[model samples]
Target: MTEPERLRADAVRNRAAILRATEELLAHHHPQQISMEQVAAAAGVGKGTVFHRFGSRHGLMRALMQERAQDLQTAITGGPPPLGEGAPPRARLLAFLGAMVELVARNKGLLAALGPAPVATAPEQEPREEHPVYRAWHGHLSRLIHQQRPDLDDDMLAHVLLATVHSEPILNALEHGAADRLERTLRDLVSGLMPEG
Candidate 1:
């Protein structure tokens, strides 16, 4: 291969190796305790490669989170319902929240280690309506909302409803002793807010 092509291929390999190592280690341990050296050892790459690929520990953590978000978006879009399909709107909403809660529970250590990343940024010029994952969740929720409450603006309601489901306040509630209560409250909220026929 040409020299430039070979370098590109190697760069891709390095990034993949680093991400895989980070995911595996973070799955069982907290990010603060997993040093760059340990990640390199786990990936069987030199420590220099980890630094070169990710620039710093924080960058690595951000990449891991972005990867996870993309994976979760796919699974929820295509995996199975109530998470994926075939369930009632309330059931689907509950399942989605439950799945998120379980994921948070499983990754609590890693999350505590990474700290809060800013939740919002400048909107991309590309219309989010055209994005597959955005459309999937928004479309599903919109349809369900319209079915229950035709008087409400489905798009607006879907946005607000999902924002509540994912907001930090709700996550905090789940992390504390209020997960069950929160779930019931969320279902009740959805029921009450949805339009009656």
Candidate 2:
């Protein structure tokens, strides 16, 4: 490959390495305790590399979240079945919620770290609505809800459903082996929203 192409490839590899290292560190240390220096050391790159790639700790966490959610995003955007484009709106909504429960269960540590702390909040923190991932999920839900129930306020309802899946109570339930009950409740909530055919 040409010089520029080689550099680009190297950058991609470096980015992946950094994300993997961060994931490893998050598995052991609290997110607040895992610094860029540690990430660089584990990733076999310079501290500057981590900062350069992600800008800050928050940015790194967001990148990690995006990476973890990439597969779900792809399946939603292109893959077949209820999670994708081929199913009814209610079915898609149910599938999406089910997938999100799995995702949140797997990444609760990272997700909790990424969220605002109740004790010490960042004054200039971005709103949840402004986050790209939240926007994508909300937009998808809004569209599906609108398709299923045109008379309802799709935007608010989407937010409510998304909140239900991402709420701390749900996360705690997942941790406590209450996934079956959680799923049933979510399914019932969504099903109740749809008009009977």
Candidate 3:
């Protein structure tokens, strides 16, 4: 029995309302196009309430992304063969990359809302690695690639692979009717890297 096990009523209601409003707004607009003020108004709560609940727009986006991201993470860590445990390195790697493509596509609007940090031109520029989603994907892919080829720099390779799914490229693919080609493209890339059995 803990705090969440006890479950406060108002907190539950507020959380539900906020999430519902977020989903509604996100359906038609990118995350960056919306704001805390808009979310508060849509949620029927004060701005303070929004801040209290989610800290910032980034936090709100992260909370929304977490459920979907967690699903992919669970599959990679424990779900089943090919995507999870007990699969050959190449199979699992392909599955992981494919899953990433799906996740990015599904959350296209959210990623647009949480774009890559602006290029650093000054001391006041924000941290470059602020997106938790990218960090998670990179870490997971690094581990998988490292297991396959210790001779390669897995971290850099992971960055390069994940870069393929960045919002700019993905959104372009979607517009040019080439989005369906992404998974196959990744499959070919990974196969070329790892070579066939």
Writing each residue's lDDT as its tens digit, candidate 1 over 1-197 gives 99999999988888888889888998777678899999999988999989887778876876665566566666667888777767776666667656544555455545555443112212543354454544555677787778666888989977775565346676566557665676566677776785233
In the range 109-168, model 3's lDDT, one tens digit per residue, is 776555632111113444434456567777888888888888889999887887776547
Candidate ranking (TM-score, best to worst): 2, 3, 1
Instruction: Tell me which of candidates 1 and 3 scores higher on TM-score.
Output: 3
How well does model 1 score by local distance difference test? 0.67
| Native-to-model Cα distance after best TM-score fit, residue 175 in candidate 3, in Å | 4.8
* Candidate 1 displacement at residue 138 in angstroms: 5.4
Which residue pairs in candidate 2 collide? none
Q: Which candidate, 1 or 2, would have the higher TM-score against the true structure?
A: 2
Candidate number that wins on TM-score, 2 or 3: 2
* Cα RMSD (angstroms) for every candidate in the order listed: 5.0, 3.1, 4.1
- Candidate 3 to native Cα RMSD, angstroms: 4.1
Please report how far candidate 3 places residue 92 from its true position, in Å.
1.2
Can you give the TM-score per candidate against the true fold? 0.63, 0.86, 0.75
lDDT of 2 by residue, 1-197 (tens): 99999999999999999999999998888788988999999999999999999999988887888877777889999999889999999899899988877777767667777763211123476667776677888899999999999999999998887776556667777768776677778888887878457
Error of model 1, residue 91, in angstroms: 3.4
Highest lDDT model number: 2
- Would you list the clashing residue pairs of candidate 3? 32-113
